[model samples]
Target: MQTLRTDVAIIGAGTAGLSAYRAAKAEGASAIIIEGGAYGTTCARVGCMPSKLLIAAAEAAHAVSLAPRFGVLPHGMEIDGKAVMARVRSERDRFVGFVVDGVHALPEADRLVGHARFIDDGLLQVGEHTRLHAKSVVIATGSTPVVPDALSGLGERLIVNDDVFAWQDLPRSVAVVGSGVIGLELGQALARLGVRVTLYGGSHGSVGPLTDPKLIDEAHRLFGEELHFETQGRVVSATRTDEGVTLRYARADGTHSESTFDYVLAAAGRRPDVANLGLANTSLELDAHGVPRFAADTLQAGTAPVFMAGDANGVFPVLHEAADEGRAAGRNAARFPHVEPVARRAPLAIVFGDPQIAMIGKHHRELTQGTFVTGAVSFEDQGRSRVMLKNHGLGHVYVDRATRRFVGAEWLGPAAEHIGHLLAWSLQMGLSVDDMLAMPFYHPVVEEGLRTALRDAASQLDRKG
Candidate 1:
């Protein structure tokens, strides 16, 4: 067999792998990047960018439907599903093309295109031809959607988020069986686009990583009014049929019922794609999830000359987080036994559903009770929200009772994605409630809602004094 050697070897060619490759090279290390799949990021292929494209179309259609509320009387507005899918696909391909082109610019000899398996620590087998001895390795194989065995019988009728973007046209009806970010965003977008969507959430009753029971309830109430949502839904049986697929499900009460749909999307979530990497052959320890144990700050998989980054690490699957971890992993692998921990950004996550869902800094569940005070605002009557009729959600900003510092926020409202960034920055800068309240807020805008929430927090602080 042919043999190759490198100072650093990066597996997978997605965002993290590419970033790792660049960072390793920048660290003055000879690096080679490997991939066994298409040369595009998950964000470009089926994750962030493509999903947002679909959401953009859904938002446009939804906005038109709400034109009557804004005193804009319009004629008949029809949604062309084919055209919507066509634009989504075309634009998604454009984004993917950019990433692919960057991959092509890399040295051809440094790229390997075959499945890589760990024959031993620091040793990888790439197909049958190449035995690569990597001084240090970075595993950025990313993640794959998990399909529960119960839903496996649906055959071709079963799909995932990746399958959704490949559609020639949107399906007439889709039964979404997860209520996390992917499920909520895609399910709501489909519903807005006039597709029949039935979303079945897990028993936790939480949506989009928000753990505040109040926010969760508000979310269920809001989404239930807009779409067919079952907060606690479980699938017991699924099978393919001549027409479509049949499913037996259990509701919140544990009662069994049956339903049928054109397609069943197993959006339960994703797991690190490490099952086929022959990890058992390596000496590195595995975590509860069966992935290699790695340090988040340095991205090192123990003391071995190996690192883990991006979705394969199974920490935060966000794109920016992946990129950051990739850089850390690459730098650490290049430096090896002399690695240092890198400071990470403040925690932030956003769900792109209507009136979006977001959490900045620490999530609600992570905070201890009686140590923090909650300052809330309801967009039901907020100025700009009322003006635009896009105000129908709640927001809560958490402040430390002792320090009066802005700890975090969980909000569901208009401009949540933008607001999330502001809150994240506040957390990073250690801004206090008064510090945030002192920031200027315009006369009439969604940001005023944030100001109002901060003002409320300030008032609560005054009461304590």
Candidate 2:
């Protein structure tokens, strides 16, 4: 076998791996990145960009359909499924091209196109040929979609988020499994595009990033009114048919029903792709998620010269988080014994459904009872939302009772994506609730809704005092 030595070796050439490679190289270390799959990131190819493209098309269609409410009559509003998928695929390929080009620009000797398996803590086998003796290693192998065994029988009829962008045209019907971000976004978009959609949540109480019971209830009320979402049951059987797949769903109330759809899209979430890496051969310990045990602050795996980052670590799966972790892991791996822990940014996540959903900082479920109070504002009555004829959603901001400081927030509203960013920055900067309220809010804008929520919080604090 061909053997080589390097100061650092990074597995998987996706976001985290790429970031780690750059960081290691910047640290004056010789780093080689190994990959077994496509060069483009999950975000560029499957996760974020392409999904947003589809959502954009769905939004356009939905907006045109909603235009009649302003007393303006229109005609020729037809949604061509083939045309929609064409734009989505075309734009998606453009994004992937950019990522692949970036990879190609890197030194060819520094990139290896093969799967890497651990031979030991600092030793690895790439594909069937090369053996690498890395002084330190970073496992950034990312994650893969988790398909339940019951749906395994249907072969060609089953699809994942990756498979969606490859379609030449939108299907007539789809059965989306799971209520996570992917399921909710895809199912809602497809439904907006005039596709028959039935969303089956594996079980109730397991929706997207929102953990507060109130936000969860708001999600159920807002989304249930717009789409055919089922959270009270699970799919038990899937069988391939000539036209599509047949699904058998068992309800929580002990009843069963069957239906057929052109496709069964699995959005059940993903798992770290670390199982076959021969990690058991190493001295490193594995975590509960089956990844190597690592310090969250340093990304160091146990006491070994190994680090785990990105989706492989299962701490945070978003792109920005992956990039940050990769940077830290790579720098630390290069410096080794002199490694230092880095402070993490505040948590932030957004779901791109109609009336976008967002959460920043600690989730509602993570907060201690009576230590914090919630402030709320309903966009249904907010002036700007009403003026725009887009009045639908709720917002809640959490504040610490003792210090009256801004803590976290969950909102479902027209401009939630933007609001989430503002809140995330506030949390990261450690801004107090009074500090947020003191900021200038332009009159008659959507941001004024945020001011309203903050004012309510200030009033509550006053009452508590």
Candidate 3:
């Protein structure tokens, strides 16, 4: 058996692992990343990069399709699904290669491609014989798409988000199960591409349990995506026929219904992927949720130097937040780490449905002593909205009346992604409503919506006083 020693050992090569490796190197620690599959996991292989690429292409196709409605008699409107997939896949591969190169460029980090398991509390056994030991370890293995065993029996007839990118042909009709991030993003992407898409939220609302309920109703109205949302949609069953897959589900109403489509995409969400890491052999603790339990700041497992990041740590599974958490874990494992352990600040969540949703900080119910004030500016109210032809969204903000400090901000409209960061930065820096109002946002821009929100918030405070 070959034995190797390192300062830190990171499992998985996804966003969190890559970030943690770099941060460990920045702190002068020798680290190596062990990936079970190819160098890139979900984010590179299918999740973020590839999925977003397809979404962008769909957006383009949608624009072309809508040109006629705007009185512009455009050329023939046709989308070659195979050609689109090929181009998007090639581009995704190139971007993944670039990211891999950047990760490898770190001086003190090494990358290994194979399965790794914990033989003991402090040692990882790769393959049959090679043993790797480190002072600290991070399990950033991330999560995997969950397919109900009954539905999975349909096999190739059914697709998941990971398989959607490889589809050479578009389905004449498709059914999307689940209404989480993966379901919503991919459903809209496919719908805009001209596929007859029906989304099965399975939970009485277009949005999943993780999202605000109000936004759920808005999604159905704007996306025009058909939905079958009901309570008790558990244990879904699917079957394959000559046409395609037929899905049957039951709900709290005691009604059993079925839908047939040329393709069925299961977006039932994800569970942490840590099965083969030999976690059962170690004394490392896991919570009732079956996730590794650790302190939010230190991310340390028990009293050991072993740490957890990304989905394995149970924080929101966003790439940016994972990167930040990875940096924290990497630092906590090092001697001269940046900033002593601190709980993460409020995070920003951007969901890319028809009317995009972005939010940061505490909700109104979470406020204690402060008077809560909120204001919203509709996209229809902005000049830029007319020019850009984006009419179905709004920006809302919540501020503490006494201190003028912003506690929450949400936007549902075009370019919401770009505007969300401004709110994130302001909220993170504890900027007040007055401070945000004083800033000069360029006119005839989506950012003007922010300025208007602040103005309305100030007005609300005045009215309340």
Candidate 4:
């Protein structure tokens, strides 16, 4: 077998792996990256970029449908599903090519195309022939969508994110199996694009882990208008028929129901792709979910020279978090004995459905009612929402009663993503409720709704004192 040596070896050429490779190189280490599948990162190829392309098309279609509300009448609005998907795939491929090309530009010796397995600590065998010895390694193998064993029998009738963007034409009807971020976004988007969509969330009735029960209820009320929501749906079995697929599910009350759809999307969640790496050869102990135990701050696994980053660690699945973790892990792996932990960013998550849902920093469940003050504003009457005809949502802000420091915020309203980022930055800087309210509030803007919430929170803090 061929033998090679490098200062750092990165497994998987996705976002985290590529980021690690660059960081290690910057630290004056000779690094090589091994990738078994496509070189483009998951976000570029399947997850974020492609999904957003579809959402953008869906949003355009929806805007035309809602144009009547603004007294702007356009005739014969029609959706060409095939053309829409064709455009999505075309754009997605372009984005993926950019990432792939970047990898190809690396020195030929630094790019190894094969699956890598650990033979021992700091040693890996690539594919069938080559063995690599490195001083340190970073595992960023990413993740794969999880389809339950019960749905395995459905065969071609099941669709997942990996294949959804490649469909020649949209399904006539689809039953979405999860109400989390992916399910809600796609389900709502498909429905707006004129497909019959049924969404199932099991018993919790929660969408995208919104900590506030009020926000969950509001989401159900709003999104339920666009798509059918079956909160009690728990899948029991699935069968394929000549027409499509039939799904039998149990309700929270022990009742059973059956439905047939042109397709079933298993947006249940994803699992880290760490199983084939032969981690058992290392000192790392994997959990039941096949994730290696690693320090959140340092991204190091135990005391070994091995580090975990991105979805492989199964900590935070968002893209920005993965990039941050990759940089930290790469730096520590290169620095070795001089390793130091980096500070983690405050928690941030967003679900890009209509009236976008978002959570930043602490969740409502984590705060006690007596210890924290809350402020809220309804978009139903907000000036900007009314002007934009998006006047149907709510925003809430939380602050420490004693210190008036902004702890967190959650909102289900127009422009939630933009508002969430503003809150995330403010909380990261340890800004107070009053400090946020002191900022300029532009009139007839959605952000004025945030200003109103901050003002209310400030009043609550004063009352507490």
Candidate 5:
């Protein structure tokens, strides 16, 4: 077997691993990145980039169909599922190619193309012929879609984001299991593109971790207009038939229901891809879920030389967070004994569905009633929303009641993604409600709606004093 040594060995060449590699190399350390899957980060391949491409196509189709509402008469509009998917794949390939090219440009010795598993602490076997000895290791193996055991028997009838994006065509109808970000985005997009979509989830109370009552209600109202939502039930069983797959579930009301679809999308959630990594070879202790307990701020895996980052740690699954975690892990791994802690970015995430859902900084669950005050504005009557014919949803701003400082925000409205970014930046800078309200908000813009929420929060603070 060929033997090699490096200052740092990074497993998984996705966003987190690549970022770690660059950071480690910048620290004047010899780094080797091992990848078993295809190049291009998950975002560029199946997660964000390709999914957005499909969503954009779906939005265009939806826009044309709604032309009549805007005093425009349209005729002969048809969706070619195969062609739509082909363009998505063609464009997706280009993005993936760019990332792949970057890896190819790296020095041959720095890039290893094979599966790597720990032979023991500080030692790894690549495939069967190569051995790697490293001062420290960084794990950024990312995550995989969670398909429930009940649906395992459905086989090919079941689809996840990975399978969906690679399809040459979409099924005529789909049952999307989970009302989380992935489920809501794809389910709505598919429905808009003429696919019959029924979304199933735990309950109609919330989507994902969103806990704001107002935002939750707004999401239900807005998304219900786009797709069929079955939020009262939990999936219990699945079976494959000649036509497709049948899903059976029991509702909260103790009623049983079953439905069949041409395809079933399991968007339940994702689990860290750590099971096959031979973590048992190291002294690292894993939690019940088989995840290593690591410091969120330092990205260090306990007191061991190994570091964990990105989706592999299951801290935050978003791409930007993965990159940041990777850099921190790489830098810390390279500077092991002299490690310095790095602060994590304020949490920010967006769902690209219509009236895009977004959460920034602390969520409602993190804030106590006596400590935090909330201000809100309804887009139902917002000027820009009415003008754009998308005047649906709501926005809420949360602030420290005593200090009037921006704490967090949640919104379900047009341009919530943009609005969320503004709030996230403000919160990161420790800006107060007064500071944000003083910032320029254009007349009749979606952002003005955010200003209203801030002002409301500020006023509530004043009332308390």
Candidate 6:
């Protein structure tokens, strides 16, 4: 029955929730962050950072192994899986330690490591006894890995993205259950490390904002994975065997098949973690997926005063996007009486695949009345891509024909992540084709293609005129 008071209460300490707390603090609002598990986040603990580290190590090992083929053998290439795992663990610990300490250092913020549930509209209960009351609450609890109904008791052996880094010994082979960003990224990483990978997905169609079908095909091809691409094969059941796990799958044509692997990873997707937040007590609405639905501009629950961000709000659910959205949501919640919602640009979705994919703004199908112009240049045409022998993938951009404004850009290449920065800037600034083309990007860099692509898109404007 202890009562606590705050101006804002953040229900998560992950990327989005943490950002929202800081945003509220910056506005001179008092806030307390209630974390269910550990501090840090999926990005810091399991998702982006650790996964990318492993992928980078795998790529480095692959590069060393390929050195002999390039006639540049330095010493020898040998992968001690133990050593790789040790480094991953040590790095994760150091990084997370820093984050934990930093969270504690926030004088404006208070932390509670316990699961929280809403007792009433403005009242929240945490752990066994602590109760808090706040004028406004932000739910940035993020999402959790989805284990399909088909796989029930196949725990431990049937893993997800979070379980990949927990391995003390590497599996010789693994069957990845989804071809989405995390699945493809993890599968490619394992493949590069000499682990046989089989990727299964029901649809070959693109899912994320980087909605390019060709890039996905390139991923399957480059990894040489057993791809159930463009298929109706969905996992029906999983059973733990004496050695590994057996996956039963059903195709669209009603044919059934089975595959056994050292491990089966369910990377299908994630659901918003809104289970015990007590949404039933509030007027806040939820989508069909049982996620809170909020106004995109304000990140408000439409119930005013109450806001949701990150995966809870279902904006983009990416770590970066969550942070950005959380900040906006916090600002709006604290100053809703004085501020008006403004139109922000669409988010960019960057996927780290074999040939990384970076996509931004609207796709060809998303445009309503704006005429679309597209430009594509293969990585084979770039100097750096040639030097690195990464002559696959392509760089492309879309522009509105009327205003000549950049609508979107996508790259599948070594610098796809870096190129995403340029696209994000262009979209945020509403940069015209001419404005983007004028930027002095370095020659021989993948960014040089941005200039060319923008110029090409601009030329289409002239042709139409």
Give all candidates' CA lDDT scores. Answer: 0.90, 0.89, 0.76, 0.88, 0.88, 0.76
Task: Give candidate 1's whole-model lDDT.
Answer: 0.90
lDDT of 5 by residue, 140-183 (tens): 99999998787797878888989888889867999999889889
Best by lDDT: 1
Where does model 2 exceed 4 Å of error? Answer: none
What overall lDDT, based on C-alpha atoms, would model 5 receive against the true structure? 0.88
| Model 6 lDDT per residue over 200-273, tens place | 76544343344555654555455443334423368888889987888877866778878788888888888888
* TM-score versus the correct structure, for each prediction: 0.98, 0.97, 0.91, 0.97, 0.98, 0.91
lDDT of each residue in 189-210, candidate 4, tens digit only: 8998889999988667678768
- Predicted candidate 1 versus true structure: per-residue lDDT over 313-422, tens digit per residue: 88889999999888888898899888877568998999999879889987788999999889899999999989888889999999999999999999999999999999
**Looking at candidate 4, what is the lDDT of residue 80?**
94
Query: TM-score of model 3 relative to the true fold?
Result: 0.91
Clash totals, every prediction: 0, 0, 2, 0, 0, 0
Which tens-of-lDDT digit does each residue in 94-119 have in candidate 2?
99999999999999999998888988
RMSD of 6: 2.7
lDDT of 3 by residue, 1-465 (tens): 778988888898788888788888889888888888776656777888888888888889878876877888886878898888888789888877987787677553377667999988879997765689887888898887787676776767778888887777777888887777888788888888888777766554546323434444555556653333333355367788887887787765677778788878889888888877888778888767566667776777777777788877656788877888788877777653333574576678887765677767764345564477777777876888768677677667888988878888666778887788888888989899888887878877888887888889999898878
Q: For candidate 5, which ten residues in a row score worst on lDDT? A: 201-210
Clashing pairs in 5: none
List candidate 5 segments past 4 Å from native.
203-205
Model 2's C-alpha root-mean-square deviation from the true structure amounts to 1.3
TM-score of 1: 0.98
